[model samples]
Target: METFNSSKDFLRGINKKVFIAVLSVAILMTTFSAMAIRKDVVLVCDGNEINITTFGGTVESLLNKQGIEIGEEDKVIPELHERVTDGDRIVIHRAFEIQLVDGNEETTIVTSRKTVEEALNSLYIELGQMDKVQPDLQSTLEPGDTIRITRILKETITENQEIPYQTTIKYNDDLDYGKTTRIQEGRSGVKEILLEVTYEDGLEVSREVIEEKIIQEATNEIVEKGTSRYLVTTRGDSRRYKDVIVMEASAYTAGYESTGKTPGDPYYGITRSGTKVRPGVVAVDPRVIPLGTKLYIESMDRTPSYGIASAEDTGGAIRGNKIDLFFESREDALRFGRRKVKVYILD
Candidate 1:
């Protein structure tokens, strides 16, 4: 009887121990199930699903629990640290970087836009009427797309230019040199120049060739020669003619006609003192203002005066303060009129 009782007690204790062990396993399983499943939350980040086992109540906590760290350059559809619930969609985007260059200068721009045109419009690159760009205005933009801007402002410039007068020449004698006999004289020349220019921000940029032409032609001239002559009788006695000095010169038609313009004869209006004179020749009488005497005279009408004259010949037209002016043309000589003028004797 006592041996059977001991067996029964031992069997009973072993059954109780097995039951306790089973119950503890069941409790552990129930706790683990509670921890693995969260029913009151949702994930806000796009491009992500909410199947992860994060018992944490918030999106940020859930990410940390999953050992995922958000980057500064990265983007999330649902903001980090946002409370999440079931049936939520989360999106994650990696940031893109772009570098820009205007001419030789460089700059950096960060944008979320996917195309170049979008980025430019966002930055307000074109601020005014003068700003310009080179690409097709409606071209589609993509990443790494490069666009060039040409900010050239065009302007027109006009100027009056001086053109040098070229002498009218006819080849009197043919030779290889640059010299040509002048058939006519030169006057003046003029021309007009129009320039097209481009600038940037009021600074001169480039000059371009546009229209060029000659507007007006210069005038030509000719020099004329005279065929008149004359002679003179001195105030001093004829016998002492050699001793008398002429204070001034005058032209007498008789002597000039004989010696003047004659190839072999001495030059016209030659003074007795061997000095050469012309129609305008006004020399001091050697007797009055010795040979080589310096004198200043008002030759042209009330115009500027001249200096230093010597005893020259007498002429038919010249008398007292009177004088004749020589000119390249007969018309030019005829232009001068008879007038009273002063003859100054320079010491």
Candidate 2:
């Protein structure tokens, strides 16, 4: 203890020791800072984060160490490879999925385009005349957004249809010239057409159908169709004589037919049953013009009586002395029609 002398001397030695200790501590700290690894870094992908150990200062270096490479358009937490600190938060992002659905077409996209038009045009899609767009064609694209394109086409087509003609027949001998007959009949036609159609939004937009020509024509048919072709005219004399119908007729009647017998059939008037009648025969009331009464009726058709007629008939369809006239053709019967005419009693 006596080696160092007084109190001042002892204090000086202690101060020097304290200074040396501090100096040594500072040097050790500096050396360790240069050699030790940096603290762990937190890297976030999406919303979740993971710890990464690195000795890098900037994000770019740390990512390189972590085997992560980023593109210009790739998403990042702090943006493209920023400078980082020990506890700094770093985020790495990859492109999200995008899908495009257009009518029946579906496209899965994996692009980093920022605009809708750029995305669509990138795929080389063309718009049509009536096609429609969903996003107005100018909208910006988001991380996971999609764009759609629609197309339309238009065209026309043609088909077929039918038409008809006219013909004539006459009993007046004044029928439309050459061949004349007491019957009228004829046939009809067929056609072809064209149609035009338009389409939009993958559906038929509109159609215009046009009728064009008759492919097969119909000829007029004549009931009792004119069969008679050539007729011999009266030679030279030029006499135009029309036939006359006679009201008088002869037939055997039962003696009891006291009021005189009525006109019968042209060929067969008597019935096999001994009943003095056939179907459709009409017997008048005696006070008006008794049974077996003969009446001359006129104005049935152009010719008074051309076909065979008979009174050897009676029917519920007949009334009074007004007998129903019968014709071979149903059409002729209907054409003769139902009409009121003058009737004269002649026994």
Candidate 3:
């Protein structure tokens, strides 16, 4: 009876040991199967779509399991420590450094917006119609990219301007050379100018004249000039003359033979025109050279020139193209023989 009891006890102990071993193995398999259970999730990164099955508890754990590394500059949609569920959607965007110059201010930013326009809109920046942008608004932004914006303001203004009159000179033959006569006065003209002024960032940049209107017309000044004849004397002096004549000139004295009277006669040395005989007085034919006409006598030969004289007398021998020059002394008259002389009528 004791042997039978001991064999039963040993077999019972082996059975319990085998049962315990099998039960421990079942528990380990159940725990491992629960830990290996996976959930389906959707991952979107940089516009690329991806579906994955991960055996992770949190978003960071799931991404790490998939070997997806996140940088400091990168952006993620959901919180990294948040627990993930079945059919969860996760999005990630890569960031880059970009410089934006808005008007007179400059700012540096790191963003994941695809284009410059989207970036500016995301920042709530508005653009005017006249404003300009550098690198284009629709251009893709990259690392170390830069953008510039210029504010343009235009305004139109009207102004009154004065147009100066042009001076014109005209020659007039009736007026003397070195003399002027005003026929008209100079007047300024009026004009209205429309201008367009452009400013950049509150500072003037450009100006343009858009339109011009003439209000008043300009008047020109006029003058008359003289074109009289002039004669240059022997002493290099110039004088105005009306006429000229070449005549035969002879010399006479206030004597009884020359004047047909003696000194005792009242009109002994008197001329036909009742003028006293003098060195500058001459007798001429009235038809050729009228009496009382002023004259300038220039010697045609080498003889001394009779500078200035007047035709105030007529003689018996003095006819057409003939003149008689008077002298006080008979000796001087006898010495002055007949000669041809040039006479000019003074103005």
lDDT of every predicted structure (CA atoms): 0.52, 0.54, 0.85
Model 2's number of clashes is 28
Least well predicted 10-residue stretch by lDDT in candidate 3: 220-229
- Predicted candidate 2 versus true structure: per-residue lDDT over 1-347, tens digit per residue: 56656777989989999999999999999878764656667987655779977665777777777777777556666655477667778867565457787767777876555566766676677777567676767887766665666666667777665455565533334332244453544556776677777766568877787657767777775533332222222232222222222232211222223123344533244442234443233333334444454444444434443222233444333454344554434455556565554344432
Please name the candidate that would achieve the greatest lDDT relative to the true structure.
3
Return whichever of 1 and 3 wins on TM-score: 3
Off by over 4 Å in 3: 1-52, 55-74, 77-91, 203-205, 223-234, 237-347
- The sequence of per-residue lDDT tens digits that candidate 1 reaches over residues 48-100 is 55555444466666677767777676666567777666544555554455665
Backbone clashes for every candidate come to: 46, 28, 4
Tens digit of per-residue lDDT, candidate 3, span 121-218: 87889999999998899899987998899999999999999988776777765566557777778898999999999999889999899999999977
- Flag regions of model 2 displaced more than 4 Å: 1-21, 24-41, 45-48, 53-56, 71-74, 85-89, 95-147, 151-314, 317-347
TM-score versus the correct structure, for each prediction: 0.33, 0.34, 0.48
Ranking by lDDT: 3, 2, 1
Cα RMSDs of all predictions? 16.7, 13.7, 14.7
Per-residue error for 140 in candidate 2, Å, reads 15
